[model samples]
Structure formats: structure tokens, C-alpha cells
Target: MKYQPIDSQLFIKNRKNFASKMKSNSLAVFNSNDIYPISADSTMPFQQHRDIFYLSGVDQEESVLVIFPDCPKANHREILFLKETNDHIAVWEGEKLTKEAALKTSGIKTVYWLKDMEKIMFELMTQCDTVYINTNEHYRANVETETREDRFTKWLKERYPAHQVAKSNPILQRLRSVKDPIEIDLMQKACNITEKGIRRLLNFIKPGIWEYEIEAELMHEFLRNRSKGFAYTPIVASGNNANVLHYIQNNQQCQAGELILLDVGAEYANYSSDLTRTIPVSGKYSERQKAVYNAVNRVKNEATKMLVPGTLWADYHVEVGKLMTSELLGLGLLDKADVQNENPDWPAYKKYFMHGTSHHIGLDTHDYGILTEPMQANMVFTVEPGIYIPDEGFGIRLEDDVVIQENGEPFNLMGSIPIEADEIEDIMNS
Candidate 1:
């Protein structure tokens, strides 16, 4: 792993929180993600399942975390089953976590090899009345591939059909939504890396530079700063490419007087930071571009203020819709007819800003948080709003990650990054 070792107490606390939510005598299990295959003898990089990573702080493949908080044997309360590392594996791959190392990394005392799982699980299952199975329940989830957790769930059910089964997703959805102090610090580190990348692009971007070149600059900055790379697939859309929300083909040559809409961020310690900034390709925004940019900035600023404690996610977006609507009206994009005849389901603002104004950000770019619940303090969100006007040959989006507060407005994590139109222009030219 490129990142530093996190404090094991974060995982310890996370496990305790999750175990408290489980039914009495229930055992919850989480599996590491499989190292996916590409072609003959090739495999994609292994990304530890976020849930397992959250609970155990173990970032390796073929690992399992079993939390039987009410186990008869005290040592079986929190167990880690890691893939056995041998001389062959050490020579071929690298050093996998040994028992001592796992203890240091995870703060769990009992660690066994994967070969011992069946025997140990049988004993634990005999003592427990229920089993918790992990599943993907994110609102945006559309999984096609059967995961390792899925395979284990099938096996567990076949072996212990008499035991009551429960879902770990609901518990995880709530626990992971609220950020621990250590987790917030890791996220802040990610945001700081993203800020460095944005600042680098500010000075590097100029006329005739290709969009891909700008992306290269940001990548260089991220890698030098201890980040594994982008939190999500970067969107380095220049000029009209910004109109296409998910545009990632950053192959176009940026022309002078055009704006480059950069939706890019860096990941540190597996926490994500999401940032979007639209800057002038020529190092200066034109009159109309500045107007649109400031309007989007205004919308983002206002939307962030709504992310305080007890605010409903759905209602917050609706209020943000009104803010965007008024901005569009001021920008002359929507008229009285467009407003009056707008479908209530998809408002008039959808024409310019189609996506949700904000989403939970953490381990995943779109992190796990139940939208049905009211917002809570320490929950990180990205307040991004945009004006996509293909007719005008440019689109503008501004985004910043913020943490909801108990008292007042949410605290902007990306507050140090330049967002003001004048500030961006000055940095670019200087």
C-alpha cells in the first residue's frame, strides 16, 4: 500500500459500533474483494472491500473478518483469517501480513490462516444463533459480478440453514455514514492532496495545452504527494466536453478563451476527495464565462450551507434546485414559461444541472450513506453545481467537499483551494 498505516483504533471502534447493532448472538462476516482477472495470467489490482477495510483495517485479498461479539470463547470475539504466506508467495508476490503484523495493523489479537477458517467458523457458528452476511446496498449499486462475499454467503447459508440470517448492509450504511475522527483526518489528507493538484493545474494550464496534458500534470502532483492516484476516474473535460457529465476522454486540445472543466481528486489512506474546478484555458475567463462560473460558485456556496445537522438529503437537493433555478433565470437560460411548464418530477433546472448537487464522500467517491436519514455532523458531502450550456460552447461546474456541523454551516474541506473567479485568474496568469 502507498499510504501510511492508519491508527488501528479506528477499525476497533468501527467494529464495536457495528457489533452493537447486530442481534444478540449474531456473527457478522466480511470478505476481502477478489483480485479480478483480466486475461491469461493477468489480474487487476486488488481493492479490499471497503466494508472489510472499515471493520478490520486489513487491506489484502483472500482475507476474512468475523465479528462474533457474543462468542462463548473471548478470543473468538473478533477474529481475522488471512491467506497463509509461504516462501513461494514471499518470493513471487511479496510479504503478506504475518500474525504479528496483522495484530499491529488491525488491533486484533487472534489471527489465523485461511486454511483454519472452516474449523473455527464451525465452532463459532455452533455457539451463535444468527449469522450476518455482507451485501452491497448502496443506492447507486448495480453489481453484475458475484463477489467473494456473495460466494461465502451462499456457502454459509448451505451449511447453517437453521441459523437466523441478518443483513450487515443496514448497520454498515449507518456506521460508515458518520465519520470517525481518525477517518475525518484521513479524508482531510486526501482533500489536501487534491488541493495541491488543483493548485498545480492552476499554474500549469495555458493555451494550446491538450486536456490530457493537464491531467498528466495533476497525476504527477498526486503521485509525488503519496496518493495512489485519482479517487475516481478523472474527468478532464475541456470546452464543450464538460457538457457531457461523465466525459473522461481528455484528448482534445484546449483552445484559448475556453474553459476546462476538471472533475478530479486524489485518494490518500483509501479515503476519497472529490473536487471540480472550471478554469480558463488561456489562463483567464472571458466575460460570459466568468458570469457562468460565478453563478455556479454561488449555487455551490449556498448548497453547502444547507448540509447541517438534521437536514434531509432529498429536501436539501430540492432547496438547491431552487437556488440553481434562480441562477439559471439570472443567466437568461430559463424564462417564465420554462419555469411554469417544468415537470415537477424533473424541474427546469435539470436542463442545465442534471445530477444531484451533493453525495456522501469517503472511502468510495460516492460513499455509503442512507439518503432516507437526516444529515448528521461529521458526514462529508460534495456540494457541486454546474451550468452546462452547449450553445455557449462551454460549461461551468464548481465543487468542494464539506463536513456537516452540529451548530452552523458545514465546514468546507476544500476551503483552501482557490474557487473565486478572480483568484483562479490571478493564479493562472501569475
Candidate 2:
């Protein structure tokens, strides 16, 4: 791992919190993500399953965690199963975690080789009446691959159909939504790294530069700061390309006097930080570009203030729509007649400003949080509002990661990164 090892106390506290929510006599399971294959003798990078990483701080493959708070034996209450390391394997693949290292990493004293999992879990399962299965239930989830957790769930069910089964995702969704202090610090670090990347681009961006070059600059900054690069696939769209919401083919040449919409973030210790900043390729925005940029910035600012505790997700977006409507009307994108004749399903502002105003962000770019539920303190969200004007040949999106506060307005984590029109202009021209 390029990032330093996280404090195991975070995992300890997470496990304790999760254990408290488990049903009586129930055991929960978590599995590490598979090292996926690309072809013979080639494999995609190993990415640890977020849930397993959340619970155990074990960032390696072929690992499992089981928690049975009701177990009679103290050691069996929390157990970690790691792939055993041998001399030949160590020589070929580098050293795996020693048992002592695993204990330090996870704060679990009981460690067993992967070979012993079935025998030990069978004994523990007999003692527990219910089992908790992990699943991907994030609102944006569109998984097609049968994950490691899925295979384990199938095996567990087939082996013990008589046991009552429960979903762990619901419990995790609620818990992970509320950030731990350490998790917040890690997220802050990721945001800080993103800020470095953005600031570097502010000086480097110029006419005729390739969009991919900007992506490379950001990746360079992130890696030097001990990050594993972007939290998600970066979008370095310029001009008309920015109109495409998920544009990631950063192969276009940034023409002079065109706007570049950079939607990117750095990932530190597997925690994500999302940021979007639209700027001029030539370091100076045209009058129309500046107008659209300010409008989107205004919407982002107002929308961020609405992310207070108890704020409903649907209602918040509705309020943001109203805010955008007023801005679009001011910009003459929508006149009185346009507003009057617009359908309720898709408002007049939809032509200029589309996409949700915000989304939960953390370990995953779109992290787990129940949308229907009210916003709470310590919950991090991305306030991103954009105006895509294809006819005008420019798009503007302003996004900032913010933490909902217990009182007053939510705190912007990227607050000091410079988003205002004048501020961005000064930085680029300086």
C-alpha cells in the first residue's frame, strides 16, 4: 500500500459499533475483494473490499473477517482469516502480513490461516442462530460481477439453510454514512492532496495543452503525496466535451478561450475526495463563460448551505432546483414564458442545469447513505451544480466536498481551495 497504515483503533471502534447493531446470537461475515484477471499472467490491481477494509483495516486479498459478539469463547467473538505465507510464496510475491502484523493492523488477537476458516466457522455457526451477509446496496450500485461476498453468501446459505439470514448492508450504510473522526481526517488528507493537484493545474493550464496532460499532472501530484491516484475515473473534458456528463476520454486539445471542466479527486488510504473546477484553457474566461460559471457557483454555494441536519434528500434537490431556476431566469436562459410552460417533471432549468445537486461521497465516490433519510452531522456530501450550454460551446460545473454540521451550515472541506471567479482568475494569471 502506498499510503501509511491507518490506526487500528479506527477499525476497533468500527467493529465495536457494528457489533452493537447485530441481532442477538448473530454472526456477520466480510470478504476481501478478488484480484481480478486481465489475461494470462496479467491481473488488475488488487483492491480491498471497502466493507472488509472498514471493519478490519486489512487491505490485502484472500482475507475474511467474522464477528460473533454472542459467542461463548472470547477469542472466537472476532476472528481474522489470512492467506498463509510460505518461503517460496514470499520470494515470488513479496512478504505477506505476519500474524503479529495482522494483529497490529486489525486489533484482532485471534488469527487463523484461510485453510482453517471452514472448520472454525462451522463450529461458530452452530452456536449462532442467525448470520449476517454483506451485499452491495449503494443507491448507485449497478454491479454485474459475482463478488467475493456473493460467493461466500451462496456457500453459507447452501451449507446452513436452516439459519436465519440478515443483510449487513443496511447496518453498514447507516454506520459508514456517519464518518468516524479518523475517517474524516483521512478524507481531509485526500481533499488536501486534491487541492495541491488543482493548484498545480491552475499554473500549468494553457492553450493547446492536451486534456490528458492535465490528468497526468494531477496523478503525479497525488502519487507524490502518497495517494493511489484518482478516487474515480477522471473527467478532463474541454468545451463541448464538458456537456457530456461522464466524459472521461481526455484526448482533446484544449483550444484557447474554451472552458475546461475538470472533475477529479485524489484517493488517500482508500478514502475519496471529489472536486470539480471549471476554468478557461487560456487562463481567462470570456464574458459568457464567466457568466455561466458564476451562475453554477452561486447554485453550489446556496445548495451547500441547505445541507444541514435533518435536511431531506429529495426536498433538498427540489430547493436547489428553485435556486437554479432563479439564476437561469436572471441569465436569460429561461424567461417568464419558459418557466410558466415548463413541465413539472422536468423544470425549465433542466435545459441549462441538469444532474443532482449533491451526493454522498467517501470511501466510494458515491458512498452509501440512504437518500430518503434526513441528512445528519458528520455526513460528507458533494455539492456539484453545473450549467451545460451546448449552443454556447461551454459548460460550467463547480463542486466541493462538505461536511454537514450539527449547527448552522455545513462546513466545506474544500473551502480554501479557491472557487470564486476572481480568485480562480488571479491564481491562473499570477
Candidate 3:
């Protein structure tokens, strides 16, 4: 692991919070993600399932975590099932977590090898009346692959058909939405690393530089800062490429007078930080570009203030749209006729800013939080507002990660990362 070991107290508290939500006599299960295959003898990098990692801090393959607070045996209350690591595995694939090490990493005393899962779980199942199954019920989740957790769910239900089944997603959706202080610290670390990457690009970007070259610079900075790399596919769009959301084909060369839109973030210790900043390829924004850039930055700042506790997700966006609408009107992108005649479902501002203004961001770039529920303190979200103008051959977006505070406005994690047009211009020329 490139990152330092997190204090297990975070996982211990997380497990306690989760277990408290389970129905009495219910056993909850979480499985590690599979090392997906690419081709014969080749595999994608092993990524631990976020739920398991959140609960146990076991960042490895073929691991399982079970929580049964009211278990007959006290030692079985919280258990970890890991792959048995031996001398051969140590010499070949490097050493896996030892039993003693797992105890320190997870704060769970009982650890078993994968081979004993069936025998032990079957015995424990008899003592419990319900099973809490982990599922992907995230609003944006569109999974096609059968995950290891999914496979285990199918097998668990078949083997224990008599037991009542409960969904862990709902419980987790609420618990994980509210950030623990430790989790917030980790996210702050991610944002700090992201700041380093963006600062590097501000100096490195120049006319005639390929878009991929900028991506390389960001990756280099992230890796050296103990980040694995991007939280999502990075978008290093230069000039008109910025008009296309999710544009990742970073092969085009930046021109002297064009702007490059970077929608990228770094992941540190599995926590994510999302950031977007559009800057000039030639180190100076045109008069028109500066206006659009300032407008987007203003919208981003105002939208962040609305992230305070008790704000409804849907209502907050509607308010953000109003702010964007006002900006667009000032820029003449929308006229009185456009505003009055626009469809209520798709507002006039949608013409320029189509996607969402913000999303819950943490473990995943789009983290879990129920949209229907009112926002709460400690919830982290991204404040991103953009204006994409293909006709003008440039697009502007400004984004930052923020945490909703108990009082007043949300705190910007990327506050120190220069976003003002003048500041960016000064840094670029320096």
C-alpha cells in the first residue's frame, strides 16, 4: 500500500455504527471486490470493496467481514476472514496481512483463513435469525458485473432461506453519508494532494503541449504524494474539447489562445477529492473567456454556501440553477425570452450548464447520500459549475470539495488552490 496505515479506531467506530443499525440477532456480511480479469493470465489491479474497507480497513482480496453484536460467542461478534498467507505467497506475490497484523489493522481479535468460511458462518447462521446482505443501491449505481459481494449474497440466501433478509445498503447509505472526523481528515489529505497536482499543472501547461502531457504531470504529482491516482477518469480537455463533458481523449495539442478544462481529482487512501479548473493554454484568458470563467467561479462559490445543514438536495440544485441563470443572463447567453419561455423541467441555464452542480463526494467520486433527505452537517459534496460554449471554442468550469458545517457555509477543501483568474494568470506567468 502506498498510503500510511490508518488508525483502526476509525474502522472500529464505523463497525459499531453499522452494527447498531442491524436488526437484533442479525448478522451482516461484507466481501472484498474480486481482482477482475482482463484476459487469460492478466488481471486488473485488485481494489477492495469500499464497504468492506470502510468497516474493517482490510484492503486486500478475498477478505470477508462479519458483524453480529449479539452473538452467542463473544469472539464471534466481529470476525475477519482473510486468505491464508504463507512462505510461498510471501516470496511470490509479496506478504499478505498476518493474523497479528490483521488484529492491529482491524481491531478484531478473531481472524480465520478463507477455507474456514463455510464451516464457521454456517455455525454462526444457526445462532442468528436474520441476515443483513450488502447491496449496491446507490442512486447512480449502474453495475453490470456480478461482484464478489453479489455472488456471496446469492449463496447466503439459498443456504439460509429460513432467515429473514435485510438490506445493509439503506443503513450504510445514512451512516456513510455523515463523515467521521477521521474520514474528513483523510478527505482533506486527498484534497491537499489534489492541490499539489493542480499547482503543478498551472506552471507546466503551455501552448503546443499535448493534453495527455498535462494528465501525465498530474499523475506524477499524485503518485509522489502517496495517491494511487485519479478517483475517476480524468478529463484534460483543451479548447473545444472542453465542450464535451466526460471528454477523456487527451490527445489534442493545446493552442496559444485556447483554454483547457481539467475535471480531475486524486484518490488518497481510497478517499476521493474532485476538482475542476479551466485555465488558458497560453497563460492568459481572453476578455470573453475571463468573463465566462468569473461567472462560473461565482456560481461555484454561491452553490457551496447552500450546502449548509438541512438544505434539501433537489431544492439546493434549483437554487443553484437560479444563480447560473442570473450569470447566463449577464453574459447574454440567455435573454428574457429564453428565461420566460424555457421549459420548467429543463431550464434555460441547462443550455450552457447541463449536468449537476454538485454531488456527494467521498469514498467514491459520487459518494452515497440519499437525495430525498435533507442535507446534514459533516456531509461532503462537490461544488462544480461550468459553462460550455462550443460556438465560442471554449468552456469554463470551477469546482471544489466542501464539507457542510454545523453553522454557516461549507468549508472549501481546495480553498488554497488558486482559482481567481488573476491568480492563475500570475502563477502561470511566474
Candidate 4:
């Protein structure tokens, strides 16, 4: 891991909070994500499962965490199972976590090697009446690949058919949505890294630079800042490519007058920050481009204010749609008749600004929040509003990550990054 070690107290608090919510005589288990393979000898980079990292702060693969609040044996109550590390293995593949290291990484003291997992789990199963299984139930999830969690769940169910099964996703969704002070600081670090990338691009961007070149610059900045790079697949769409909502080709040469829609962010300590900004390729927006950019920025600013305590995610988006509609009308993209005759399901603003204005942002880019529930203090969300005009040959988007406050407006995490058209232009021209 490129990032520094997180304070174990954060994970200790997270485990305590989660354990408090578990049913009596129940044990919850979380597994590290498998290292996926590409071909014969190559494999994809290992990413620890966010849930396990949240609770245990163990960032290595082939690890497991078990939380049993009512265990008869005190040492078995909280346990970690890790791949055994030896001197020979260390020489070949770098050092895996030593038992002592695992204890330091995670606050859990009872650590076991993977070779002893079956024997330990068998004993644990006999003691607990209920088992909590983790699953991906995020609102936007469309997972087709069976994950390590799924395989563990299948085996657990088949092995202990009589045990009462419970879903951990619901509890995790609620718990992970609200940020702890430590989590908020980690996310802020990620946003700070993203800010560095954006500031670098302001001076580097010029006519004839390839979109991929811009992506490279951001990657370089993120790596140097102890970030593992982009939180998601970056979008460096130039010109008409921005009209395609998820354009990531980033192969085109930037033209003098076109706008580049950069939907990019950096990750630190497994926390994610999402940001989107549109800027002129030539370092100066035309009159029409300036108008559209400001309109999108205005919509983003207004939408961020609505992310207060007690606001519903769905209701907030509806309100944001109205703000976008008003901006679109002022931009001449929508008229009174367009709104009046528009379908309720597809608002008039859909023509120019289609995507949702905000989403939960934290451990994952699209983090785990139950949208039906009311927003709460310390919950982080991204306020992104975009206007795509194919006819005008450009698209504009402005986004910022914010923390909902109990009083006043949400706190903008990316406030230090320049967003105003004049500020961006000034930095570029300087």
C-alpha cells in the first residue's frame, strides 16, 4: 500500500459499532477480495475489500475478520485469519503480514494462519446460533462476477445449514454512509490529492495536447502524493467526446476552442474522491462556453446546499432537476413550452443535463448509502451538474465533494481547487 498506515483506533471503533448492532449469539465474517487473474502468469492488482478494511484496517489479500460479541472464550470474540508469512515467501513475493504485524494493523489480538481456518471456523460455528453474511447491495451495483464474499457465503450456508442466516449489507450500508472523524480525514486526504492533480493540469493544458497526456499528468501527481491513482476509470473526453457521458477513450488530440470534460479523482487509503471539471483547451473559454460553464457551476453550488440533515436523496435530486431546468431555460436550451409539455418521468432538463446531481462518495466512488433514508450529518456526497450541448460542440460539468453539516451548508472538500472560469483562465494563462 502506498498510503501510510491508518490509526487502528478507527477500525476498533468501527468494529465496536458493528458488533453492537449484531444479533446476540451471531458472528459476522468479512473476507479480503481475491487477486483476479488476467492471463497465464499475470494478475490484476489486489484491492482489499472495503468492508474488511473498514472494520479491521487489514489491507492485504487472503485475510478474514470474524466478530463474535457473545463468544464464551474471550480471545475468540474478535479474530483475524491471515496467510502465513515465512522468510522464504518474503524473499520471493515481498513480506506478507506477520502475526504480530496483523495485530498491529488490526486491533484484533487473536490471529490465526489460513492453514488453521477450517479447524477454528468449525469450532466457532458450533458456538454461534446465527451467522451474518456480507453481500453487495449498493443501489447502483450490477455485479456479474461472483466475489470472494459470495463464495464464502455459499460455503458457510452449505456447511452450517441449521444456523440462522442474516444479511450484513443493510447494517453496513447505514454504518458506512455516515463518516467517522477518521474516515472524513482520510477522504479529505484523497480530495487534496485530486486538488493537486487539477492544479497541475491548469498550467499543462494547451491546444494540441492529447487527452491521454492530461490523464498521465494526473496519474503522475497522484502517485507522488501517496495515492494509488484514480478512484475510478478516468474520463478525459475532449470536444464532442464529452457528449458521451462515460467517454474514457482519451485518445483524441485537443482542438484550440474545444472543452475537455475531465471526470477524475485520486484515492488515498482506500477512500475515494470524485470530481468533474470542464475547461477550455486553449486556456480561455469563448463567450458561449463561459456562459455554459458558469451555469453548470451555479447548479452545482445550489445543489450542494440541499445536502443537509433530513434531506432524502431522491427528493434532493428532484430539487436539483428544477435548478438545472431553470439554468437550461436561461441558456435557451429549454423554453416554457418545453417544460410544460415535458414528460414527468423525463424532465425538460434531461435534454441537456441527464445524470443525477449528487451521489454518496467515500470508500467507493459510488459509496454505500440507502437512498430512501434521510441524509445525516458527516455524510459525504458529490455535487456534480453538467450541461451537454452536442449542437454547440461542447459539454460543461462542475463537481465538488461535500460533507453535510448539522447547521448551515455542506462543507466543500474541494473548495481549494479552482472552479470559477476566471480563476481557471488566470492560472492557465499565468
Error of 4 at 411 (Å): 0.8
- Candidate 3: lDDT over CA atoms? 0.94
Q: Could you estimate the TM-score for every candidate?
A: 0.99, 0.99, 0.99, 0.99
Rate residue 229 of model 3 by lDDT: 94
Report the Cα lDDT for candidate 2. 0.93
Candidate 3, residues 1-430, lDDT tens digits: the string is 8999999999999999999888999899999999999999999988789999999999999999999999999999999999999999999999999999999999999999999999999999999999999999999989999999989999998988999999999998998989999999999999999999999998899989999999999999999999999989999999999999989999999999999999999999999999999989999999999999999989998888889889998999999999999999999999999999999999999999999988998898999889999999999999999998999998888999999999998889889999999999999999
Per-candidate total of colliding backbone pairs: 0, 0, 0, 0
Candidate 3: segments with Cα more than 4 A from true spot: none
Which candidate model has the greater TM-score, 1 or 3?
Answer: 3
Compose the digit string of candidate 1's lDDT tens values, residues 13-42: 999999999899989999999999999999
Worst 10 residues of 2 by lDDT: 284-293
- Cα deviation of 369 in candidate 3 (Å)? 0.6
